[model samples]
Target chain A: MATGWKYRTAEAETAEAIDRRCEPRRPLGLRFALMRIRVETELCQGHGRCYMLAPDLFYADDDGYCHPTGERTVPAELADQARRALMNCPEDAIILTEET
Target chain B: MTDAKKYSLEPPEVARNPHDTYREIRDNAPVAELAGRSQTGAVTLSRHEDVMRAFQTPEVFSSDPGAIEIGNIRPLVPLQIDPPHHRKHRKALDPLFAPKQMSKHEPRVRELIRDLIDKVVDQGHCNFHDDIAEPLPSTIFLELLGLPVSRVDEFLALKDGIIRPPARSMEERQEKVKATGQKIYAALEEVVEARMAQREDDFLSTLIDAEVEGQPLSRDDVVDIGYLFFLAGLDTVSASLECMVAFLAQNPGHRQRLVDEPEVIPHAVEEMLRYESPVASAARITAIDTEVNGCPISAGTRIQVLIGSANTDERAWDGPDEVDFDRESKKHIAFGAGVHRCLGSHLARMELRVALEEWHARVPHYRLADGLELQFSQGIRQIDNLKLVW
Candidate 1:
C-alpha cells in the first residue's frame, strides 16, 4: 500500500465528487445501458493513478499495474471516483463503458 | 507555423531560464528545428498536443538506437526497446519500482533527509545543491543498485561525463562520453560478475535471476539495463529536488504553505514537478514520415519532445502559468506519458515528498543567497550553486 500522504487530496476530492453526484442522476427508466469501468490491460503503463484515486473500484497487481476489483460495474457510490480515475490516467488506459 | 523555426537549446541563456523560451517557441512555432547540436536535423515539438501525440504514436516516433547518442554500446534496455519487447521488460521490472515496493524505503529516505538537514540546520545558510540535493538521491540510488556508496563521486562523474561533457566541439564531446562510457561499462561489468558468482539482495541480483519473456537476461542485457538506470537514478530526483527547492526559496508564500499544511506537500510536489520539469525533453526518432500539426517531418528525423513546454501549454490547462498546489486535476506529464513513461516515477515521488516534508520541518524559511544567480545544467536542469539562507 502507498503511504497515507498520497490520499489527502483523494479524500478531499471524494467529498466534492460525491456532492456533484448528488445532483439527481439520470432516471433509471431512461438509462438503458449499464455503466462499468474497464481496465484496458494492454494500454496500461502502470502509472498507478487509477488505483490510487479509486482504490475500491480498482487495485494493482504484483507489478503495480491496475486491475478491476472483482466487479466491473461501477457501484452508485463509486461513480465519481471511477470518473476521477478515468480523467487522471496519463495513458488513457481507463475506460467507462455502457453495456447494452 | 507552416515553416519549422530554428531554436538552439545549447545556449546558456536558455539553460539558466527556459520557461520564457519554451513559451515563445510554443506560441510562435509548435514544431521547431535544432539550430546547434550533434543531432543536426533534430526538431523539437513544443506544443502539449504534439508532444502527447509523439508519446502516444510510438510507431511513428520511436526510441530505437538512432534517437539519441548517449555513449551506450547497446541500446539501453526498455528505454530503447519499443512495444512487444518493451512490455516484457516492463512486466519483469515494474514491480521493483512500484509505490508499494518504493514505500518500504521511505523510512530510510526520511532518515537520510534528517541527517543531511542536521548537518546544515544549525548554520544560518548552506549550499542546498551541493550539501543536500545532489547527495541525497545518489546515496539512496547507490544503495538500491547494491553499489558501494563510497564510490558515488566516481559514479556521478561518469554520469555527468555522458550527460554534460565539457568539450569545445561535438567530436570532442562524443570522444569524452565514449571514454567515460567505457569506464561505466567496466564498472558495471565488475559488479555484475560479482553478483553472478554469488547472488545478493539487490536490483542487479534480482535482474540476474529474473526472466524476461521466460528467458534469463544475458550479461550484456543486465549491463544495458543498468546503463539506463545508472544515468536515470543518479540524476533525475536530484535535479527535481534542486528545481523544487529553488522555486520555494524564491516564493516565500509557497514555502510557508508547506510548513503550515504538511498534507499539501504531495500535491505541491506534483505541481512543482509540472512547473519545474527538470527532465525538460525526451528524445525520439521519427520511425515513419509523419506530420505534426501541418509541419511535415521526414522519417528518421530526431525529435525532442519538450516535456517542460507541454506541462505549461495553455491548451492543456487553464491558467497554465499559475502554480497551484491545490490544482484539481494534475494530468501533467512531468513523467512523460504513454507506454514509455518514466518507470521510476513512484520512487521519484516518494523521495521528493519525504525530502520536502523533512526540509520544511527543519528549515521552514529560506531564500536564495544574496547576489547569487543560479545556472542550471544543460540537459537535466540541476543547479550546482543553489545557495540558500534562512
Candidate 2:
C-alpha cells in the first residue's frame, strides 16, 4: 500500500501504459468518436505533467492530484496534444484508446 | 584516498561548472562523501538510478537532514519531515500551487514579466539576473506567503545566508547560518502572529489553519514551514533563470530556434532545468541501516543526493552533458522524485515558461555582456548579476 495516499490505483494494476496508436484502426464511425482515455489509479502519482502539457484535457483534485477531465474523448484536431499528454505523464497512468 | 578526501564541493574547481565536477564524481565514486561531515556522516549519490532509489524510499533515507545541507540551520517543516507528516502538509498546500492556480495567476505573472522586460527592452542591454529573473519569483513567493514585497531585498539577503552563508571556515559558516535562521524566525513570527488574528488567502494563512495528521500546526511549525518555502522558492528560480539566460546568450542557435518556434519552449525549459539545476544537491539521512548498490549505510548517517550529477549521468541520459531540447522522455531529478518531490515545480515551470515566452516575444536576440565575470554561489547555483546585451 502507498502510505498516505488518497487517490491510487488498485493492487493488481501495473504502471506500464498501453498506447493504441500502433493498433490497426477499424473504420466504423467515420473518424468521429469519443476517444476513451483511461487512468490506472494505482500508477498515478499526481505529478500533474498531463495537466501542464495539456490543461484542456486534464485537471487536478483538491489535493493537487491530477485527474483526466470527465470528457475524455478529444476532437481529432486535439489528438496530437492528447497523445503528448499521455506521453508526458510522470507516472505511466494515462492510456489513449480509440473506442466508442 | 579516503571517501571524504577524494572529492570536495568547494570552490576554485566547482566555481567554473559544477556539472563537470559532478560528472567526474559520478563517473568514479558515484556516492561521494560530503567534506567536513565525518568519514561516514554523509555520502553524495550522483547516478539517476541511485538518486531516485533514495528519494523514493524516504522511510529509509530521511529528509530531516536538510539542516545539514543548509549549514546546520534549523530544520525546515515538511521539507525536513519524513512521510505521513510530509504528506499532510503537502495535502493542504499542494492545491494552492496546482495547475489551476497557474492559469489563475498567468496574467499577473505575464504582467510581472512584461513589466520587468519593459524596463530593459528599450535599453538594448541589461543585467538579466537582477532586472528580470531575480524579481519575478521573489514577488510571487512573497505574495503567496503574504510577506511584504517591500521587504524583497531583506528577504533575499536572508535567503542568501540561509542557503549559502558567506564564511570560509565550516564552523564560522555554521554560526552565521544559525544567526540568519534566528533572525528570519524573529521577523516572520510577528507576521505569522498577525495573520493568526486576521487571515488572508495566502500560504501562511492556509498553513496557519492547516492540519497535519488531523491536528492543527503549532506557531513554531508554521514558522519553520514558511522559512523553508522562502528559502526554497526565492533563489532557486532566480539561479535557474541566470543559468538559462547565460546558456542562451552563449548558444545563439538554440535561442534562435526558440525564437523561430515558440512551441519548443516547454521541452527546452525541461532540458534547461535538467542541464543546469540550481538546487544541485539535496541532503538526506538513513533512518535505519540500509544498503545502496551494496553500500552498507548505517543509521543516523547523512546522505547528500547530488541531483545535478544524477541529471548528467551518462548511464541514465544519452549525451548527458549536451542540452537536447527535442530529447524524448527527458526525466531529470531537477525536482527530485517520489513523495518528497518539489511542491513548487508547477509554479517554477510556469515562471520559466513565461519568462522565456515573454522574453522571446519581445527581445528576440541578446548575448552575454562582455568583459564581466559571471559569479555564482557554491551551494546554490546563483549568479548575483548576469549582464546581457542585445
lDDT of 1 by residue, B230-273 (tens): 99999999999999999999999999999998988888988898
In model 2, which regions exceed 4 Å deviation? A1-44, A53-58, A68-100, B1-4, B34-40, B66-74, B211-214
Query: Could you report the DockQ of all the candidates, in the order they appear?
Result: 0.33, 0.18
Model 2 agreement with the true structure over A1-100: per-residue lDDT tens digits: 1111121121112111112232334435655665656677645656766655554445565555765433345657657657776776654568888755
lDDT of 2 by residue, B63-168 (tens): 8754274633456777888877777777777777776676577788899999999999998999887899899999988988899899999999998887777786
Which residue pairs show backbone clashes in model 1? none
Interface RMSD of 2: 10.8
- What's the true lDDT of residue B315 in model 1? 84
* Residue B236 error, candidate 1, Å: 0.3
